[model samples]
Target chain A: MSRLQTRFAELKEQNRAALVTFVTGGDPNYDASLAILKGLPAAGADVIELGMPFTDPMADGPAIQLANIRALDNGQDLAKTLQMVRAFREGEQVTPLVLMGYFNPIHKYGVERFIAEAVASGVDGLIVVDLPPEHNVDLCDPAQAAGLDFIRLTTPTTDDKRLPKVLNGSSGFVYYVSVAGVTGAGAATLDHVEQAVTRLRRHTDLPLCIGFGIRTPEHAATIARLAEGVVVGSALIDQIANATSDAQAIDGVLSLCSALAEGVRGARA
Target chain B: MPANRAHGALLPSFHSPVENAMTSLRTGPDANGLFGSFGGQYVAETLMPLIHDLAAEYEKAKLDPEFEKELAYFQRDFVGRPSPLYFAERLTEMCGGAKIYFKREELNHTGAHKINNCIGQVLLAKRMGKKRIIAETGAGMHGVATATVAARFGMECVIYMGSTDIHRQNANVLRMKLMGATVIPVVAGTGTLKDAMNEALRDWVTNVDNTFYMIGTVAGPHPYPAMVRDFQAVIGKETRDQMLAQEGRLPDSLIACIGGGSNAIGLFHPFLDDKQIKIIGVEAAGHGIETGKHAASLNGGVPGVLHGNRTFLLQSDDGQIIDAHSISAGLDYPGIGPEHAWLHEVGRVEYTSVTDTEALEAFHICCRQEGIIPALETAHALAEVFKRAPNLPKDHLMVINLSGRGDKDMQTIVHHMEQQEQHA
Candidate 1:
């Protein structure tokens, strides 16, 4: 079985939803970002999505945008993001890692080289926010050949007809956008998320992780009841943005992740 | 985990819906948004709701006879469509090469050709019972058009413009304000056209229910590119008949400046089947092609998706859109319309770039020789005539699309000239 499928199977057996944590790589500083990534699995994060900063991130809300700005200001590039991922992988094992961002940097790096470098760095999946399933055919085959899952996002707008296409190409848990707009724009609606997740269940057997607008423990718990995993992005980045030191930032993220995990566990029970 | 099962099972099912939709739309030349492998609806999942909604609405709107009649009335009465094809006798003689004719879109009511699409969109908004109209503008021509239509229809108008543009094109800002449209100055991300679009999309998402987004160009997702093209088809319709009557035949070449490519597409659509009529599109090379400052989409851009559609865009290695610099505020956009990308790929239209200096030269040449001050955006097209005129025999005739007048650009030009004088 693939790493994603194996991970999902284990989670299913345990009757537990996965805890997905997102952090902007090189945010605050590169060393701090590396330390946080190394510590995440121990702090109850089952999956880690390291965000590569871009100049104009249309899908990101204020919190993550600010985090990305900080990262870019500190000189984070594709090489730097990859190096950080490599360093994190050296000391840690078993925790699945995904690189999530826009497609320009990857396109610039050359798709084949990017996939090779990502696979070498122990990246299990990728979620390019701007790459839709229709356009992903070019990247998907190469990524799959490299044994990396090309993760896809299904939003409220992703109809029943389009869901199968998204899921078919996607390997790692499908990211269900909880809102129609950018990340952290509003509160997660359980009713809408439930409808999306229920609809998605008919199309794919892969784990479904609800994200975008997922803020509090209550929000995570509500979504976790229906979803196989819950990914928190803008809220965690917001906390990290306000932290004075790397340790303080990691501590805050760990607490948030733990609380969210507990909520998911409670809902599962 | 095998490829055989995945591709085999999925290919058959996927082809059906896409094929059905393509057939319903009667997509010509390009196969299902192929556009010779350039145009497609490549957008994020979040934008699907808006894209689908617009596509469904546009499909129904296109077939509705009442919608067609309302659009026609607005085109005839509001925009004064079938705009004159005036012979630039003095300018043609001065050029000393081809006989030039100007498709005087500048004479359109409220100024510029922007109202052609604005009138159609506003009428559609009214039919949909939309209470508010929101738009993004760079040159303020589109903002003025949208605001004018909104005022006529008694609907609220909100226009987002770049903070830099508001200062550079202050006259247009003032005009929009006087027209009772709230002109929101966007402060983020290079403070230009792309930023204005970003702000507009945010506003649209926030007010999706009661608002109609009056996109200024033949860009954006599925329905927008096709919808705007259909509305602007009046330009080509007028040019075709007017040219036949005046010149006794179709002009040898048709040229238009491409911003988001609305004006170029407007002129190019009717002549698509002519095969013999040479089509040319001029892109803004702000300083020079080598100077790394321009909005020449096809010449200095790669394929990418933005604003809900796949097209040629000036983007970084990471896919973030770069800030486009041009003398003309209207042409300062990173991405071109998807159809232009298709045209470039298929070799249907010969795409080229004009430097800021070359455009300014053309601007002054037209003013001195023809006694007409063309918009900087249109000057790009005029500049191309100079380039082609030197190579062609004197008998060759070229029709240049005089998209808009230079009134809105006076303040910007004055400021630019002052900066140049200070440097010198």
Candidate 2:
């Protein structure tokens, strides 16, 4: 089984929600980002989402957009990002790591080579924002053949007719974008998410992880109870944004990650 | 299957030998929205449903006689349709090669071909019960057109423009405001046309309901390229009729500047199967292609996905869209229309570039010789005309689509004029 399957199975047995943490591959610089990646599992991240920095992140809001700018300004690229993942794998084995970003860079990097290198470098899954089910034959089919999970996003606007096409070749987990707005904007309402999750449950057996607006630990904990997993991204990147130096960025991100870890862990207990 | 939508699906990929070429080649985009592997709706999923809805509405409206009649009335009374086709005697003599004619789209009310598309789209927006109309513009021509239509129909209007465009084309910006539009200035990613488009799309996703995004150019998801082309084909249709009446024959060639390629495609689509009439498209080369600061996508760019379509664009190695430079604000965008990308590939039209200096010379020459000051965007096409005309025989008739007037270009022209004075 893939690492995502194994990790999700373990989380199922544990009878608690998974805490998925997201950060850019190299937010401020290489060494500090690597240090944070190595420590994410211990800080309570069941799945680590490493963002491949892109220039035109149209779907993302202001905070994560700034994080992408910071990573690129620090000279991050696909090679260095893969190196960071490979280095993180050296110390840990069980936790799943997914790479997320737009599709153009992968298209520019050459798709077959990117999938091969991503698999070799220990990437367990992918979530390309702009690619839809109609165009899934471009990357999803190939990545699945390479034994990597391809996560698909469902929005609040996804009706019954469109949900099946979205869930057709999806694996690992289904991401429920709780808001119609861009990433990192604000939290989603509980009633809307509850109804959405119930509707999605009738369609697929895959684990549903809700993202897009969950920022604080309390918000994450509340969202954790409603779904199989909760994703925290912009709020953690906000830690890096407020830091004075690379050291502070690394410490600030992990420290907040630990606090969010506690919030999600304590929810069921 | 609906009439227009289903017919669009059944279109043949290319022209057949026996078919009258005057009938358009709508075989493009297929069901997957691929115009011979160039155009597709590659936008964020948030906007997908809205785009599909608009396309369906447009399809229905295309077949509705009432909608066609309403649009025709608007075009005739509001936009001044059938803008004159005039012989340019001085220009033809000066070029010394081909007999020159001008489509005179500049004489249209509000002074460009942009109002033609806006009137068609806004009428559809009303039929679909959309209360708000939003658009993005680089030169502010399309913005003013959208605002004018919105005021006419009593719908709320908003326009997104880049900060640099707002500064240079302030006259049109004020004109848009006077027509009851809220002008939002975008200050992201080089603060130009591409940036303004990005900001407008951002607003669209956030306010999906009650809002209709009227893309100014031919480059977008399917139906837009085909729909906009159909609306503007009035230029080519009038030219055909006028030439038949006046000169007793079709012109040998046609020329138009391409910024997202609306005006050029508008003039070229009706004549696609003519087989003998030559077609040319001129792109702005801001500094020069070699200097790496031009908006000449066919000359200097590669195929990539941007602004909801896979088209030719100026981009970095990592697929990040690079800022395009042009003396004309309207042409300072990274990508050309997807249909233009396919047309370039098929060699149906010859694509070339005119440097900023070359277009400036043509602008002055048009003023001195023809007593007409063309927009810097149109000046690029005039420059190409001057180059090719001098080499052809004098009897070879060539018609150019003078896409817009020069009133909005005064700031850029004045700045260049003062710089020349300082240098002298």
Per lDDT, the best of the predicted structures is 2
What is the lDDT, from 0 to 100, of the residue B287 in candidate 2? 93
Model 2 residue runs over 4 Å out of place are B1-26
Model 1 chain B poorest ten-residue lDDT run: B1-10
lDDT of each: 0.81, 0.86
* Regions of candidate 1 where Cα sits further than 4 Å from its true position: A159-168, A194-204, A244-255, A258-269, B1-31, B127-129, B317-320, B390-392, B420-424
Candidate 2: which pairs clash?
B97-B394
Task: Summarize candidate 1's per-residue lDDT along B94-134 as a digit string, tens digits.
Answer: 76778788999988997898999999888778877899999
Per-residue lDDT for A18 in model 1? Answer: 85
- Write down the C-alpha DockQ for each prediction: 0.36, 0.59
TM-score of each: 0.89, 0.95
Candidate 2 lDDT by residue in tens digits, A171-190: 99998888887888766789
